[model samples]
Target: MTAMPMTDAPAPASGSRPLTRVLIANRGEIALRVIRACRDLGLASVAVYTAADARSAYVELADDAYRLEGTGPQETFLSIPALLAIAHRAGADAVHPGYGYLAESGEFAAAVTAAGLTWVGPSESAITALGDKTGARAVAEAVGAPIARGSAGAVDGVEEALRIAEEIGFPVAVKAVHGGGGRGFRTAADARELPTAFEAASREAAAAFGRGECLIEQQIVAPRHIETQCLADAHGTVRVLSTRDCSLQRRNQKVVEEAPAPGLTAEQEQVLAEASASILSHVGYVGAATCEFLLGADGRLSFMEANARIQVEHTVTEEVTGVDLVAWQLRIAAGERLPEAFPAPRGHAFQFRINAEDPAGGFFPSTGTITACREPAGPGVRMDSGVTEGFHVGTDFDPMLAKLVVTGEDREAALARSRRALDEYRLEGVATLLPLHRALVDAPAFAGSGHTVHTRWLEEDFMPGWTASLTPAEQNGAAAPAEDVEVVVEVDGHRLTVCVPAALAAPPAPERRRSRRISRRGTTVAQDISGLTAPMQGTIVAVDVSPGDRVSAGDRLAVIEAMKMEQPLKAPQDAVVKSVAVAAGAGVRSGDMLIEFED
Candidate 1:
């Protein structure tokens, strides 16, 4: 692929304009990351937060902190005016949007630039051109990068989506034109699934990015998710720093990632590097960006999309390449030039996303106060965390609590180190993926240098019979009666616990047996046999069942939107809905009744 002609872009900052202060328009670990970078450069950092994050670590670490008065994301971090106002009040000379929220919004970038503050990312024009999915595809096509067949641009509606899906063949992906981090991405195996997928993708895109427009593409079957970390300067230089494999995923979200994607041939690496550089240079993109691709088992590469801002897995690339991508984003925004070449990647690195989710329960988002936390540390291990003991994890935003990255001289060594790090890590009062991470590091499909895993490996293969074993804390994490006797046991590597009457354990028959049952099922519907209740906190986006409606097992009864993803609540068995307890758009708690069934 050859670099195409450049588009109109903002003029480069005049001769290395220095930045004195930077406003971080985000929350959590990323905000703390940018604050640390600002400190490294001797630049004052300003932090903004909602009521939920008022006492977050990032706020206290920043040089100045302000509050954005509101509860939800729209009223807080996603509000451009609110962020700009904070920047103005803090006398911030630059704005850094650390992933998610308005990070990929061209409007936000333009607004910051219009306010005379440097935008620490690609130029607004670059973002406008490439941030949009359809525009990105067009750019890729112009540069002759390999791309999957799909619609030219956003489809008109579900009908149009169906038509496009058919023309491109079934098993199409409906993707949001804006945003990243898998917020608005869905796959439909056939026509029966396309409508729901389209609607869900659009709704999520609109809510997450303030844009509902979506484009359809032919789904790549069982491909490794590969991406290249790229850096660009205003002086017409683009560097493809490293390749990363985010093949281990669930719910279309990456769970594990590594740098210099394993098992890539020399030719594949060359193609990825060239195509990424060409695409960014063609759009006059500046600062840090990532170009993603799908590598088929047959050794073919297909362009996926370009992320305009830094990504969650940049840590893996940094570990292997020894580069601080966030600091480079700041330097590039301040008119610094990139070196002609970056050092070749070394060794191996892996990043495990420590999400506040219950792996045993279909990765459903979990929230609670962090009653205890023990982060890992040692040679070749780094923990980028956002929460602390006493910090409350909520469903109002992404459930990721932190990133655990480990590196070593090689892939095998890295995997071994990851196992140790995961064992050292611990948390309480909230369900997490820690046990899953511990298991994944040693799984046959993920371990060793010759491992074969794809984007759907976790969902399709690894999780089929996999179950998460609870720690002693997790077993006792929930409140229980003082009279309840808890007994824990392990059978065939599966942990099982029971709290029952004292007589039951005495080898004698009791007049009555009272016990609490535990089930490892998807946490969208209640476990009760008579009715369905919400298993987590969220808002009901749709109600597919009504009173007297007949439903069979596995039929979607409703959908709950939480943590920017939609989880479908399904009927547990054949039943007629006797009554509906919750309406669409209603907020619900863990035990709130959603539907009732007659005996």
Candidate 2:
């Protein structure tokens, strides 16, 4: 195991209100994950769900369930008051903010503690300090860890960003001060792209993290993304489980992860462990956390930021280290001491995220009920999912369907296991990343020297041109009808549920909401220059041009916020704006016209 220093904080007394119940303030896979952890620890789990997730698989698995009245996150998961109320009603002794939504919210942590509920995470002060990208950079510097050369703190405006961009040179990354999973990251190769990148990054940051603060850093060309997994108890004992290589990514979001990252020297490993331990110790962080760093081609390691909560890829670490990270979080929160040190790595482990996206169609999100489902089984293959055969994937939450983790004695064996697992995984109704993962494991580049591939290799080099052939209908822009949906409606604080048979099917996809176009076979219709239409469903956050405005082919005519990313709608050709069809804050669908241009 990775090494660190010892501490003397006392454990909570055995008689001090032992935690027997936990309320999960999240949804989907992570909620199920926490419930399983609670079960393993002989504790009961309560779940909270929004109207959109009333039938989620995880909610059904929890010991008890409570409904929060709303659809989107703001009215459900992100609502601190609503979550606390559920805890009170459920008689929950603690709350587990599983991974997204409020997992890293310092305010939520403070609120949970103030409500006299145990929060299964680090202290609020630590969350506030390390959760802020800019603040974490400062902490890294103070702890003698190397950090990238860039802005000293959060950038305020375009002018300030321009100055920082000049100082950091070209090919700079505009990153949110409180973002992860690449949700709030953008790169600008030159000054021309800086303004758009900065604004989009800031907006994405605000939408995802509720903070628009950003910082500019020089993009480390072709660097490897590595992180150290840490488990610390209230007693100040912090143990590093293993290093994970999250180099396989798309748009900064990790796609594939493995433990004991390939191609690192002993010295590199030592430095990573030391750097992670130093930061976690300095902040007095407790529970589960991970310290991220970027390893450059020259072998220099620069601290990126710290995830103050257990990360999505923690399973890879668990696979290699034989440690239960979520259980550790619960134990540490209950003031129990961890083992003095964790065991050494036993085998190589790989994790592939199964996202509900159509890789053949620009990775667009696909939502529908899973008509059929099957998963890989047997030794060394594990699936952690909150989805099943009848599960309905929706747009109100993250697109991930589940995670597949596999282990073997070595990298080659692990790759073989992963290939078998991918082959065994079968599902119908919605598209997934399964085929992409299948191709990667079989590719010679990924099997041999490909082990060291960088984050951009997949999307930029391979995936764009890869064959995701499924059916002529799917490729030629014909989508199967959405299955009939049955919903449970609440009336007078009572439950009323309605079920519709799949054969009945729902109405033809709304006239203005064509779900997809531009498939792998390249058969989708071309856009009409006389009118501008939304490319996908999202909220129109801005209209950049007005009627009668002249614009070039490349001008950004508008911006849409969807899935927490800011997508720019650009002009297809030089044209004069005839009319603005949609207003700011309007809800739009893929085929909804947003602007009209002069013929």
Candidate 3:
């Protein structure tokens, strides 16, 4: 639907401002999405990049680009001052925070408005009301939306959390008050697991969102993850565009999502749409937002939370509904009003996130340069990518390299298309989720007619039996090079099809190789396999073992934080800790010694 002219209706707190140049305070595919939207609206787009992201695809496509002048995220994307200064330098009249980073930061929104620039999102007050989990829950309750039993507010400590969990029953979820994208979300099956889950969740929350306060909620076991894509304008119009199913997850994070959630009855659809519109309307929210819920086996819907920004899976909705959600964010911020109604959902679409992770290695994050890249193309295939061939995938950011969206006339057709698209898609250089996605399309649980998959189905039912291998890039770069292709370089008069021995290959290219002494699989500590070593580059978040501590095989020793996920290092064999080398918060590279085992 087209936008109507601005009227005398009461506008959102962020009043309409003239649109010209828009600065995107984000990176990767989402930034590219916003840039294309700006171009479609005849507006100039400005891009900001960190030192590591200088060669990203979005930076090159932007009308103007500015260097963030920083080494990491804290000094670049998460720095309010840096982003604002770049906005001023670019002469941008508006700032669009594509999802993540400071996208949900109310302070950032207020600061943008204070600087007399348009914030292309919900008003500051609206974000503040909904950004906090407790406030969002209250709003949902006030609006008569369905909700599950949860703590009154953010719990004080583990004791308080346990008390709340007891009151709500076991099998509960510990969620960060300011968490999104499943960063600080954890689950507990019993009282014994609550404390560790709580502490880890809080530490992760502090690292990701700068807040440690969390709330406890009753877990809806084995439920389908459903959310409604809602859009509101300054003129008080809220439209529920479509419903999506994001139940296929790993470690509480979504991997595959489909638009127009399948198997929902007419009543369930009405409930989702009504509740979504009511929650946003109650908060006087403007711009795009999502209301999440859990549909139980009994067909009851329970409110989960609300996200105050565009989501990574929003592309599937756009494909099926024929609505340009990103463009609407720009137009709505420029004082345009939404029409009375939106078109009904048309076709079915599925989105697969291609993350740089090794599924066989327990989804370990893999870092390497993109040696080869090939995307799929057909009537119903779309690839939104941030990297090109030769672009390096590192541990500095999220593991998601791109998204693959496939659409068809129906769910069956969409699944068929997804199979073709996934097979046709080819990417090398780093390990990714391509293999797992290929397996998912044909899995009995996923392709079954009754929709048997749930939130925990991936880890509990699927992954335990599934297995994949390292990509060619993983073996070539992270380990020793594969057998060299023979070529004759006239050496003395002899033409030789020489194959360089693996032992003689250039010490395994420093930048590409993970560790000099560790094995290719990162299981052995050194050439002799005498100690434990880090498997990837990341920060040590926790060290459970100390010097002189005796540990058995498979005992937890430490935890490493990389690509926003925590990986626990376990003792490979029964041994006494001879010494400890790394401490919590220490940065480490692959093959770096962490603890030495006694003889």
Residue by residue across 353-470, what tens digits does model 1's lDDT show?
9898877777888888988888999999998999999999888898999999999999999988998898788787787888788778877778855778988889988776555543
Per-model TM against the reference: 0.90, 0.86, 0.89
Pick the lDDT winner.
Answer: 3
Instruction: Give one digit per residue, the lDDT tens place, for model 3 in 531-583.
Output: 88888899999999988998987678898999888877878888999999999
* Clash pairs, model 1 backbone: none
lDDT of the candidates, in the order given? 0.85, 0.81, 0.86
What is candidate 2's lDDT per residue for 472-538, written digit by digit as tens? 2432355544333444568998997544444443542221111322244331123577877876677
Q: How does residue 61 of candidate 2 score in lDDT?
A: 83
- What's the residue-level lDDT of 60 in candidate 3? 90
lDDT at 169, model 2:
97
Candidate 2: which pairs clash?
Answer: none
Candidate 2 has what TM-score? 0.86
Ranking by lDDT: 3, 1, 2
RMSD of each: 7.4, 9.1, 6.2
